[model samples]
Target: MEEVEVVVAHRDCATLRVGAVFLKIDSDQSRTEVEVRAMALAPIPTPEIRWREPPVLALAALPGRALGRLGHPETASSAAWVAAGATIRKLHDAPLPPFPERSRADLAAEVDGECAWLLANDVLPAEVVTRNRELADPALRPWTPVFIHGDLQVSHIFVADDEVTGVIDWTEAARGDAHYDIATLTLGHQTRLDDVLTGYGPGLDPDVIRAWWSLRCLRGIRWLIEHGFDPSLPGGEIDILKSRM
Candidate 1:
């Protein structure tokens, strides 16, 4: 008998895998709707949807391994990271998501709210949060919007033999800053950023990318804690923020 593996089980959603099939259960059907719609529109490789019944979505698993994950050392080759970048460029150059344009104000407020919570809760030293807040400011400025993955965390991207195999978890897909995806891809692996940029083409600002790193880690610390994830793990978000000092 094949054992069922629980990939992730948060209050908002849960993913289970049995054999080559993944079962996604979400409390909010709208997210599933977005995932389905985004996959259909994305130009890159995505898992095939086997079935969709309210609250449960079945998908065929892709063949490759995730590029890397947060709080862990990256093991993928430079070529693979570059390939991942090329794959993202393809998606960004594709047509928009057809959904209402996302609000930049809302994104700023969310970051501000998280920073406030970090201070109020004494989550970290004041200097660390304050400094990163200043560093994260550039990300607030407007720019040309593209269809973004919203959460292109390294683990969501898979690669094999120096090529991108697939990208998963499209619930947060929306029209937003393209660099957000680039920043997310290089979250803990900033050293490999040059390789990603090599395949992503030009016109990206490093200052903006650095700012987003602060914004994402600062904003994400709250959710990671609330959802029972440790952001303080050696190379995790906490360290990422402190290093900004």
Candidate 2:
């Protein structure tokens, strides 16, 4: 048996890699259900599903390396980022999945709850949390929902030789605002926005994208902390929020 590499191990879920097969073990079966359904519906390249039983979903790993890490500069060429943008465009244009019950109102409530937790626990400075919370409010306004790769961080996108090979981690895939995907992809790497946007094509609302950026940071910090990550790192979630100020 190959040594199992722990991809992620948190309170609610865990994922492990055993050679070419990824075994995801989650406490929430609904998330796994959504992942399976989303993968079945997505138009883009995703990992092959080897099998699934209850809380464990087995998948074949993709061929290429991730596009980049969350806190580091992407060494991939601009063409790769552009390709990622195009891939996202294709995903956005695909038929909507049956998931996404999270409305803007729901998101606002989540933000409020998380912000209150941060303040109550002194997880972040009051001003920083308050200001970003205010900035994130506008993103709660209504927008056309589309099939989105709920978490499109660079690390989730795979590429080889400047071509997109596959995308992974579909647990968050749902019908949501399209700009949310764009913001998720470009969160910490603002410098690559132009490259991604170029391939994503025109007719996007920049302000909404920016607002999602703030919202993502605000919503992510607590989760990262809970997952044993320090969001205060130079390129961490806090940095993403501060950059917008």
Candidate 3:
């Protein structure tokens, strides 16, 4: 029998891997449902659903390895990164989902709260927090919405033989700014941005992408703290924030 490997475990959800199958357990079935719907909607390769039962959903493992993890050197070839970007472009070009993600006003408020929390808790120096807050401002401006994989982090993308094989973790998928996806994928890996943009085509604003990097890092710090993650690690969120300094 294959051993059960714990993939992820937190108060909100947990994921376990058993040989070729992955089991996802969520506190709220709505997220699981959304993941199901989003994977169905996605144009790129995605995991096949083995089965589902309420809070638990089983998915057959994808064939390729993850593109890479944050805080680590990326091993995938430049073409692989470009393939990931092209895959994202196809998804963005698809028709919009019926529901909307968080509005800009709500996101702005959240960022304000996170900034205040980070400062109050001494998580970072006030100057750093203040500067990042300023940098995050431009992302709050309006954008044309598109179908987006909300958490397009490196580890969620898979590649093999210089081709994007599949993408996973669709819990955060929603209709959002295309640049947000671009920014999220390139965060902490700035050099790869150009490679991604190659297959993603042109017309995206570099300033907006940079601003989203700041916003995402700012908003993520508090969550990382509460969730027992160390964003201060090398190449982690703190490093990403400090890179802009």
Better candidate number, 1 or 2, judged by TM-score? 1
Q: What does candidate 3's lDDT look like per residue over 133-199, in tens digits? A: 9999999999989999999999999898999889999999999999999999999888999999998
Q: Write the per-residue lDDT of candidate 1 for residues 1-245, one digit (tens) a residue.
A: 98999999988899999999999999999999999999999999999999999999999998889999987887999999999989999988998887666677887898889999999999999999999999999998988889899899999998889889899999999988888999998998889889999999997888899899999999999999999888999888999999989
Candidate lDDT values, in order:
0.92, 0.88, 0.92
> Would you list the clashing residue pairs of candidate 2?
none
Deviating ranges (above 4 Å) for candidate 2: none
**Is 2 or 3 the stronger prediction by lDDT?**
3
* lDDT of candidate 2 over 1-245, digit per residue (tens): 79989998988899899999999999999889888889889999999999999889999999889999888866989999999999999999997888855977788988888889888988878888888887877778888888998999889999999899999999999898888999899888888888989999986777788888889888888898888889899898888777766
Residue 32, model 2: lDDT of: 91
Task: Give the C-alpha lDDT of model 2.
Answer: 0.88
Global fold similarity of model 3 (TM-score): 0.98
| Alpha carbon lDDT at 160, candidate 2 | 96
C-alpha-based local distance difference test score of model 3? 0.92
